[model samples]
Target: EDQVTQSPEALRLQEGESSSLNCSYTVSGLRGLFWYRQDPGKGPEFLFTLYSAGEEKEKERLKATLTKKESFLHITAPKPEDSATYLCAVQAIGSSNTGKLIFGQGTTLQVKP
Candidate 1:
């Protein structure tokens, strides 16, 4: 089975603080890794896509990197507005015809001003 697990279910950061969260995954065959940011009561917004080991993507103060067995999301100098849930999902080979994603429970980040 393909599965994703995120650590530190929640985090609290002071404004301008930087940190990195982890996502561990197990799958029969890895196809893709996805990162998303979701605000309260809203749907997830796509952030990055990592297809292979050593691949990395960045947006604003966020950077996402992928490895064979895990992925990491790093936040730099975050602001209060950056508070949101960071989600990591994976697409596994032979899991879907349409390349659907299975998501982790998510890491909720709270940035204090």
Candidate 2:
């Protein structure tokens, strides 16, 4: 079955601490991998898209890298404002190009100030 799994379902980090979040997925025909940051009571905010293995993207303190079966979100020198539920999703081939996604359980991060 095609699915996505994220580890360390919750994390607590002190401000300025660095960490890495993981997303593992199995899909029949992968079209894209996506990352989003969700704050409480708010919709997910798009972070990155990875289309192939060895592909990587970065924004601010977040870096996303993809491999054949997994992807990683590396947080460098995180701040309290960066705390949020990070989500990973995959879109399979033949699906509509209309921003549809199959999401994994998110990883909730709390960065202490």
List where candidate 1 sits over 4 angstroms from the true fold.
95-97
Error of 1 at 108 (Å): 0.4
Candidate 1 shows a clash count of: 0
Tens digit of lDDT per residue, candidate 2, span 1-113? Answer: 67899988999999999999999999877899999999999999999999999999999999999999999999999999999999999998765545568899999999999
> lDDT score, residue 81, model 2?
94
TM-score of each: 0.95, 0.94
The models' CA-based lDDT, in order, is: 0.92, 0.94
Deviation of model 1 at 60, angstroms: 1.0
Error of 1 at 14 (Å): 0.6
Best of the candidates, TM-score:
1
Please report the TM-score between candidate 2 and the true structure.
0.94
lDDT at residue 80 of model 2 (Cα atoms) = 92
